[model samples]
Target: MIDKNRVFRVLQLAGLVGLLAACGPSFAAESDAAGDEIEVVPVRGGVYMLVGGGVNATLQIGDDGVLLVDTMQEDMAEHLLAAVRKLSDKPIRYVLNTSGNPDQVGGNPVIAAAGSTINAGNVAGAIADSTVGAAVVAHENVLTRMSVQDPPPPFEGWPTSTYFFTPTKDVFFNGEAIQLIYQPDAVTNGDSFVYFRRSDVISAGSIFDFTRYPFIDVDNGGTFAGTLESLNNLIDLTVPEDKQEGGTMVIPARGRLCDESEVVEYRDMLTIIGNYIREMIDEGRSLEQVLEARPTLAYDPRYGADSGSWTTDMFVETVYREFTANGSSEQ
Candidate 1:
């Protein structure tokens, strides 16, 4: 069961947590108001959601140590660490990057540096010093993208462990079975869905933003088809307790906590919009015509934005481009 009181207290300390409106290829800048402090919300089975710093991060705590999924922005590292300290004094043994976006993995250097990794010693009973911090993990594509950035990331921020060509990577950490399920060509080629099996929680990266329209990075292998497929996969992994409510909590890259039903609602919305866009493309409608059609008109009031880094217009245009490009609409 969730600790409602704890969540309420965290919310009080964190103030009004605003929904993330624009998370493009490079996440749009957020005001210092929400970024200045970190709010920790307990999920279940030792899992917690650290809400703030431009992105929501997941933490798994146990006697062994702590496992973190998606460290927020670089500027928020100090506050993030302070928030983590409030939860557990143990070192952060593992850091998982859901995507290569700055908001998702920006705090890699500082957060990792504060952690200590345990290593075996050459001698029979000696334990090696653990000043090396936590082992950062991500998909191989993440490392590739971050490596070639205009101003490369610090060495410490780079993912120390990466997996490629594999559908999933599994790690048993902090008394839970953690699975890093790669989401190919969705939000980005490096996107991952971190599932904590025992805890029944999933750390959905940029693929599922509860706040606004999904940002599909066309340049980085993100596609509308892939996004829909990843959402389907997430739904499959989620199981509801009763009446499609509760059970299998989902922590998105940004926004409040969610469950299987919310994922279904999001999936259905995307599917409906995709179908509308596809029908327009088949009708030989130009991008302008489709934009005028207002396929996402209904959802705009909730998930759409007229002005921001990523607006409803941008979302429609991207989908239109993806569908018409090389006749991908047939797919």
Candidate 2:
């Protein structure tokens, strides 16, 4: 059963935690005006969701150590640590980020190094230590993005490991097969759908946001068709348990845990909206005309219009640009 209080805490993180990527990794989580508690809810198997200050991070605990899919930015790293202590003190072995977004990878430094009690006097040695507590992992494209972000992000919490495998990158730890499957041109060129074979869970970053419409970062190589394709791929990887309700649990970037049914609903909604936007664009309608139509009007109430920062209109605009711009022609 899902805990209501835990769900509320996740919502609190979504509405409160805000991260600034260009500011560097040395920054700390800002103390909340009234302070907030970090909450961890078990999803399936050993996978759990750490919710507090920023985006939802999937936590996998085992005898070997701890593995995280997304890390809330620096703002709530300490709180995240406290929450993790309740689970296990075996140390955080890997910090895997699904994309290059700050909210997703911001806490890499803090969470990854939780096991190391000894502090390094020199920054040089910490960077050189590869076998220790923390090892940040992400797609190679994520490294490329972090390196060219204007002034360039500091090396404090950068990815220590990256994969450029064509279809999947596999890692074996704690007697489970973990695969980092690439989802290119989806939310970003670096998007990855992490599959935990033993746990029967999938950690989908921004590709599956149940709280609102999909966030397509076109400038970062995201496209409409790519987004849908990734969603389809996520569904293909899922397996329902009984009554077609609960089987393969999916941990999204933020929001509630989803099963195969939820993914199908979300996919259908996006397809309908994307088709509507394409029809409008094909008719030579301007962005203004398309926005006026509000293609997602039917889904607004369920997803919530004033739910958070990213709005429904913003999603429509992204779809419009993806088809008409330099993105993939498959759509």
Candidate 3:
């Protein structure tokens, strides 16, 4: 049976514990006002999610070294480095980012400072194109979109490695097989999720976060349907229902080891909001009207309110834009 009480307690304590204890004694420094707790925690196996008020990072420990999915903030790198050191003496070999947010890839220079190369997906392609010394790794799309931004300065770290067009990219690191699936226009353009094939665990980056509502960076290719499709694809790869709890683990960008049911709850919540927005849009409701409709009012008791930077209004806005955009596209 799922221990409901334990889950709530963890959420409560999450504001206090930070991400170090769960991973031996790695010192991951968290910023003040980042809340009392660092948002990091160990769900199952050697996979750990660095929590708090930033992007999600996944750590895979191997006899050779460690493979990190994402590292948040340049300031927090030392803490992340310390935390990893506590868990094992393994050096960080690969850093994979799911999207193009600074909070997700800001730690790149820090890793470089520590003598470890940070590998980002499409997001890092911009930096890789400009700099000669940086070891940026990513797909072609990431490379192509690097300089659409402004005075067109050279990329900081161009992709030293690239993958062809495919929904999923596979890699063998730290004695584990990791499958990275790029879901176009989800949380952000070129958003990706990491699946630990052998561990049956999914590090959902920001795609499956419980802390706040979704933020669709439209300029960067985020869409409502894309996020849903991405979630469905992930669900298909998880363990079956009967083996939850002790079975496969689903680690979000924040929070505890989520089960299939919790995932369903989140999915259903999104669906409900999507449907509500669709109905409103079909009725010729404007975006402002949809926001005022407060379709998620009933859910406020649970996923309502703000947990740090994420708020109810933000969730409503994200859903409204996505549904409206989707509605427009179908026509």
TM, every model: 0.87, 0.81, 0.74
What would the TM-score be for candidate 2 when compared with the true structure?
0.81
The parts of candidate 2 lying over 4 Å away from their true place are: 1-35, 115-133, 304-309, 326-330
What is the C-alpha local distance difference test score of each model?
0.82, 0.74, 0.61
Candidate 2, run of 10 with poorest lDDT: 17-26
Q: Candidate 1: misplaced stretches above 4 Å?
A: 1-33, 120-128
Can you write out model 2's per-residue Cα lDDT over 1-331, one digit (the tens) per residue?
8656435543543332222222233123322322347667788667887666645788888866677888877777787788888888766667888998877877767777664321242222322343465767789999888888897666757787788856787766556888899998898889999999988989999999766787778777877788899999999999988877778988877666678877887787788667767777777889999888666666665554654666777778778876788432347
Candidate 1 — worst ten consecutive residues by lDDT sum?
16-25
lDDT of 1 by residue, 122-200 (tens): 1233243586878889999999999988889998989988999788988887667889999989978899999999989
| Top TM-score hit | 1
Task: List runs of model 3 lying over 4 Å from the truth.
Answer: 1-40, 52-55, 115-159, 241-246, 305-311, 325-331
